[model samples]
Target: MSDRSPAQHSDMLLFLTDEQLRQGIEAMFFAYQGFTADPDRILAGMAYGRAHHRAVHFINRAPGTTVNNLLGILGVTKQSLNRVLRTLIEDGLVESKVGRVDKRERHLFLTEAGAELERKLSDAQRARMRAAYRDAGPEAVTGFRAVLEAMMDPNMRRKSSALKESST
Candidate 1:
């Protein structure tokens, strides 16, 4: 149990006013912008955007993931994802293969060049996250992650949790 008294807990909850909520929302917006700044700069030179970065990041996280599974994870339309996939494939950043057990399914993996680009993008983001985590301390980082998970939609939360589980 927490050490705080009932009155103290109640008072803390009451402190979350409209203005406080707005400030929190604004903070999240700015934080997201900062989080993507480095990657955005790198992608801009290559004529890509956040969508491309997200696809590469996820494909790297789960190598040999199917296109259908990726569509679910990304929550994007098939046409939109197809466009990105086409570009990545044409650039030799990603390779697509037919599933042995399910010939109809297409499994995606990063090519050597794709892995290098993924490393560059992730390194930038990781450095920012590492610094932020260090500055926030362990407890704040934990709380921040909890807040983010709570903010996700139920389907997205499940997908994210599955990815986390798979990585471990």
Candidate 2:
């Protein structure tokens, strides 16, 4: 693939053998496991799992996010998200307020305890990502992000980019 023209690169990608694609898919599976390993360990002790971690992370990112918006972001069923939210709320990690203007809407915010948990989870992930990016190098990091973005659904990509921009 080295020194290939962009057209050639496209052609090569289009013609990737089943074996090549399989290897890439396998790599992604393993990489995801590695990425989640630390957080999984932390969540295990709390009787929570990846779903809870994901909810906390996103809620921390966008305080006062509505339940409906979180449902969209997480792509989980209303019932399932409700279960997680109920647990978090009961544990005092999340506070859900009735929307002032919309009585049916529940806007979520992390309590101090929730923020602390989010910090720990994020710190672990950031350390892992930072080391991996350093090992992969700047160019690989750029290419890696491009590949990830390209793999996302267009709608999800837009949502993700908007969050990134807002965060910065």
Candidate 3:
């Protein structure tokens, strides 16, 4: 198998059974449910959904990030994001300011309330992940990250890589 030619890649599908594929699909579903469980509970009390959570998280990660920058990071339609932004802004959770260099552009920042909420939401997930990582050990965590990166679609992969670069 290790010595297979380039043409062998096309025929690789023949080796995978339908049952194996179904099992993989089921694993992803259950894993995602577990991943969202903690944050979902926190959001339930606040009348917010995953969209709001993501916006808060990103704004917290990059203070004074432009609306366009966030749109690219989130891959969401502008109207949809505008709705979320409106709610957050009205609720005093987030602030939008005119860009210093480009006055037409809106820059996003989380207010004290937004920061507190984001911390609460992230802390819940971090506690779960910290325990899981501790149990899985360092190598397993590395492999998990590698698998997730490999599974990303091309557009998402590009965005992910960009975010990783910006963080450094």
RMSD values for the candidates in order, in angstroms, are 4.3, 4.6, 4.2
Per-residue lDDT of candidate 3, residues 1-168 (tens digit): 555667735546566689988997898899789888999998998879999999999899888888777888888999999999999999999999887777877878999999999999999989989988999999999988887887888778876665531221
At residue 111, what lDDT does model 1 achieve? 99
Q: List the residue pairs that clash in candidate 3.
A: none
C-alpha lDDT of candidate 2 relative to the true structure: 0.88
What are the clash counts of all predictions, listed in order? 0, 0, 0
How accurate locally is residue 138 in candidate 3, as Cα lDDT from 0 to 100? 100
Ranking by lDDT: 1, 2, 3
Worst 10-residue lDDT window for candidate 3 reads 159-168
Ranking by TM-score: 1, 2, 3
All candidates' lDDT scores? Answer: 0.89, 0.88, 0.86
**Tens-digit per-residue lDDT, 133-163, candidate 1:** 9999999998999889989998898888776
TM-score of every prediction relative to native: 0.88, 0.87, 0.83
Quote model 2's TM-score: 0.87
Error of 2 at 78 (Å): 0.7
Q: Name the top TM-score candidate.
A: 1
Could you tell me which residue pairs clash in candidate 1? none
Task: State the local distance difference test value for candidate 1.
Answer: 0.89
